[model samples]
Target chain A: MSELELQNKKVAALASTETIDGEIATLNLGPTHPATHGIFQNILQVDGERILSAEQTVGYIHRAFEKLAERRPYNQITPITDRLNYCSSPINNMGWHMTVEKLIGAEMPKRVDYMRVIVMELARIADHLVCNSVIGVDTGALTGFTYMFQEREKIYDIYEEICGARLTTNVGRIGGFDRDFNKEFITKLRAFLKEFPKKFDEFGALLERNRIFMDRTIGAGPITAERALSYSFAGPNLRAAGVDYDVRVMKPYSSYQDFDFTIPVGNDGDTYDRFMVRQQEIRESLKIITQALENMPEGDYHADIPSFYLPPKEEVYSSMEALIYHFKIVMGETPIPAGEVYHSVEGGNGELGYYLVSDGGRTPYRLHFRRPCFIYYQAYPEMITGSLLSDAILTMSSMNVIAGELDA
Target chain B: MSEFANTIKDSLLEKFTKTSYELDGYGEHNFFMSQDEIHPAIEFLKNNGFIYLTDITGSHYPEKEGAEFQVVYHIHNLSENLRIRLKVDLSEKDVHVPSMTDLFAGANWMERETFDFFGIIFEGHPNLTRILNVDDMDYHPMKKEYALEDETRTDKDDTFFGR
Candidate 1:
């Protein structure tokens, strides 16, 4: 084929798949470039400044979590989940814990639930801070970026107080927490509750009203409710399109029913609407944290299921029964019923679901993680089409497609 | 089970004759369908208000007779706040099922991922190729028949880890 004919054939295939009209310039964005946040590539067919079509290439960081989960024991798989959307790993840890608890029929007490709620809300705030501030940085405003980083550090300090690790926190256990929250931890969390919202509002003031930021985001990458629903958009992305569907409200798990908070919704699913929806969601998370702290119940932090929760370390060293229980858990010898369960929580980005199938084994017969970022990123190519190249970056930042979650 | 979920279960049992079990009594339904019956079953559920497709995944069973591969669909009805799981079994020789991309655009990547990991083909899918795995990978990694450890590694002995 001649060169012109080859270009025509390329356009022909692109037109049939992505549907772009007339001739266009092709621009390849990166596999290792900073624009994607995580590692993914976008090949865009552009007509000058306007993007006619975009083709996304993902899986740069695929670790085969499904294949790997088949070999490891149930507890060993917790660390694997921490890598998916590492920005908010507590939700992943707690979501996995609840799925296993459901399988083993372990019921936790109200105190355990409240403590979990507190940790989960803190993770949600950390996730939104990264998203909103990154959106600000994309708009050429750096002040909010640095300001929000400090608040995120406070969240890390809280995580360090609870668990040793911060970013990829493998914190919770199958039935409950490894230990109860100490007085020191509760005090630190209350301090965070008092201090974070003010910094959050100050950061919002920098971008929510700035003229240049508003013009760049108001109409960029707008997705209709019909298309958004058809595409299975969830969390803030779906909420930004005027749909009030939230997993926490529609399907409450982990004692979320006891908490009262409003779901934030937006009129247009544009860049501006997505940012605003997350901003309001941060406020709602603050309200939930305060309520969970005030009405905190008193009981064991973990369920009394010995097979699910490890015995105390001191008892393990002193008592034979405790040592045997510790050995059973460490060696993955606990019994599990043969059944299937699907449990989901309102993750930082959207609905984080774990579909686990157990065949009376210590490990899972089959485990599937229904990551929201993986599902929501499908609409990216469609959303970015007909927008400018720079606006495509803004749309991606708003979507917050962590490469870790995308490739998993 | 919730009232609406049980209602869905009764309706589905009447039509498909598949047994409905209350999984953990958690307001969800589980049932199985033949490969040939899945397209119409999905269409029936969609018409009945299961507007959102939550996920499309595959599970491999190496020893089951006439059901070597299981293609599972997690569908949700946002209006009623209901979720249902429909599983279809296909033999190793014939691992093909009709695609739901026509119904849900979100199934595009999920179907591709299922195809990449489990080697199940979607007959009418517009594009079906390796998604999470490198395009050059020759075999489906999720199949139990495949070795868990990398075959290329030579330094470690298999007996030490009890592989």
Candidate 2:
């Protein structure tokens, strides 16, 4: 319609507000909005440009992962977890394996623990890079995203070197890793460590102090610390709200206590603060990775639990004992202690936990993943209630609500 | 359990007469409380140091006699760096339990997910409906009575799959 028709419609809407309440217009923001970056549907009740209320409808991609985990064996469940937070699959995989190890009372070597720290910190950096760059993209800054995403590809290359898969990496095994860090992985990582800071600084300079970006995100979608904690927020979102409640700092899993780092916090829990918190967290992750590499212990990469970890294909064909171990592992006949354990890791977005219950059976009696995305996405409507439509998109992006993790 | 965890356990036992405590494999404190006492217990803990609600999920057991469904809550005391687990048992016939929505805003979706997957009802939730599944879905998928595998298929054998 022309501008005259638009003016006529506005006049007509205003004239009708004498009977109805303020002429509220319902706008559908997503189910497939381009800015959403995932399948999130929001029904917004808007009066002109200001949002009065918003209702979110998720679960368009529900796959029932917890139900699937009940039938699969302990080792088979790792692949299922790979899809939960696809941005940081290594953390989920490691969290599940650690939960099982906790259940069966398997003590991993120091070398395995250090190696996991390195891999997990790398995943954290990759996860934060995706989140921050997307926040830039949502603010109409596409150049920074394109530049930083190449850095994310380099991180994926390191993942490919370790696990032979890019995204949805089933990287580690039950006891430890499938194998140690190969020479290609070490070389790529050393090169990345040497060169990433310079490229990252360039990317940061583009958006960290840009006046346009600041004006767009400074006060958009703000939440107070009290409200954030009451909503059970975690990770960068919680830290952005001024809560120092990081799982790595609080629980110290996988020898995280050995590494020295700082928990960055922000006073305002807006989109800008969330972005800044993640930015500092990437720096901390680099520090932890450097520490882990410098103090790397010397030992076997995997634990000595033959029943849990599969034997080599060569050994399985050559030796009877190796063949028997392989058969037991493949057939899901390994003895799992009947117990309940909840193990959590500091995932890319938040605390990704695995709550597993075993009844002395091959499969878990019940397995529930404490998906951080699923938990924190509940507060989106509350955060974006009175903000502009564009600010709502920026808030969702900064929250890093991956659809796979949200719907799993 | 650590000294701090034991202190919290002792405080809970002293306050609630019927509550009991056990240690899990990871040495985390596990408290068993009655369904009626859950709200008060959580409120008390919240007033004390356990301010953060980590998770809320449910598990089901068919062969168990009286208590077939267990609703679990993981509450975290972030300042003290201590974690605790609480379990409340509900039978198959009556699965009603109080909602934590009044205390934590995050409980809205977690409780809905629990109700959607296990059919356990959180009675006082403001908008308790199916989440992570279609609105018209009839059955709870996570309950043990529902088999994950296709029972009608004849091509696969259970023995070969080690079921």
Candidate 3:
């Protein structure tokens, strides 16, 4: 056959399997796909470039966090919480601590609450930056990712000064912080607060209104407000769908009610809308941290609950009561009250809730993490149903489904 | 319970007379209902401003006779800024509860996760297979009977560790 005829034959063969209507091909998006950024497996049925349906297989990294939490003493469980949504692990740690405090009815000091607000806001900024920057990376924009990552490093440095750890920071204790912010922490935070805005605004200007970014994300994987709610979407994802339901504003845990920050809501609930919502939320988080720091309360760093908080080393060495309490706590013998409490915090991704059922034991009888990633990720297949495979990847990044959080 | 929770309780009690309401730990609203009343009560709540389904999870209570499993649903009313926890106790003999996927699409995975962990079956779940665990695994890992540490491990014996 002639060369033209051979080309025609090849086109016909391709059309038979790929180009023709209703001809579907299965694509495995990952148990390990680079663009996914996490260990999520989506068995996508594609009609050419358009996705017909997506069946996701999660739990590839399921560590059985709830089961493990049931066995560990309340304090030991903080480390486990660190792994969930590790991008904003401080929020998880604090949320767990607050849940325990609520069960025990330990009233935290105003200073502790303010300190928590600052740390939680910093963690939120870190989480949103990771998510939004990943969205940019998915859309072939690498400069913004690099820039924001440097800023995230500064936040991590602050975390290091506070807790002596960076990522997966087990930052706080049951009633409040393990220790008050040191001079170094405050100085670093102040520096971060001063320098962060200029760099952040530069990053924002790079993609917020850029024609390429907008075109790539504007209507990709859009979901209506009603559908978004039905899917139990939370955080920036839900806000992108035009819902103004922020857990911070709605519930006001950790003295969030005292801060003055606006909740940004978007209209489209698409990749672009999700991106913008997170962008504006970082600004709101900055506002919250500044406010919390400006109005820093004067009091103890942690609550006066001796049974929960570890006594000072000097006291533990000199005082019998301190020695006994410290030994009891270290041995996982702290007397936790029997109660059922569901406490939620505005986590980096969404409303991170802890449903703790204590049976008056040292450890929780049952602990359920109301992981926002796991709940909202169920909507992914629906969101990207008719969109291109590229859009599917973008949508996944925009949803900010951390595999740890999703599988926890 | 707060005033808003009381309002919800009154409305819920008015509709579902078989349900019981109380303030849970931290004074949050909690409703205890039979398996039959869950779907209708939740539907009513959905119609009455509790549209957001926050989470669905199950806790295993092997010691509790006749009610070995408890399924919990946390729903939020965004307009009122109130949250209510609804629970249904399932007997070991019949570990099935009606799925709320019809009401909240988010409940699909939550119910699946519940089933995966506690073996609490959601009767109407479109896909009720194990979500976070291997499909061939014989037992749910979250049940109290399953020890947190693996029994099959031999190297980390308590005697060897001087316990």
- Candidate whose DockQ is highest: 2
Model 3: how far residue A68 lies from native, Å: 0.9
lDDT (0 to 1) per candidate:
0.85, 0.89, 0.88
- Model 2: lDDT of residue A275: 94
Q: On a 0 to 100 scale, what is the lDDT of residue A132 in model 1?
A: 91
Which window of ten consecutive residues has the lowest lDDT sum in model 2 chain B?
Answer: B154-163
Quote the lDDT for B138 in model 1.
98
lDDT value, residue A55 of candidate 1: 78
Give the TM-score (vs. native) of candidate 3. 0.94
TM-score of chain B of 1: 0.85
True contacts kept of 3: 0.81
The top-ranked prediction according to TM-score is 2
Per-residue CA lDDT of model 2 for A1-408, tens digit only, reads 632254356545544553244667899988999879999999987776666667789899999898888888888998998898899889999999999999999999999999999888889999999999999988888898998999999999999998999898998899998889999999999999999988998888998899999999999989899989988888999999999988897888899999899999999999999999999999988999999988999999999999899898899999999999999998899888899999999999888988989999899988999988998998987788666778989999999999999999
Over A276-356, each residue of candidate 3 has an lDDT whose tens digit, in order, gives 999999999999899999999899998898988999999999999999999988777777778899989889888898998
DockQ of structure 2: 0.72
Which 10-residue window in model 3 chain B sums to the lowest lDDT? B154-163
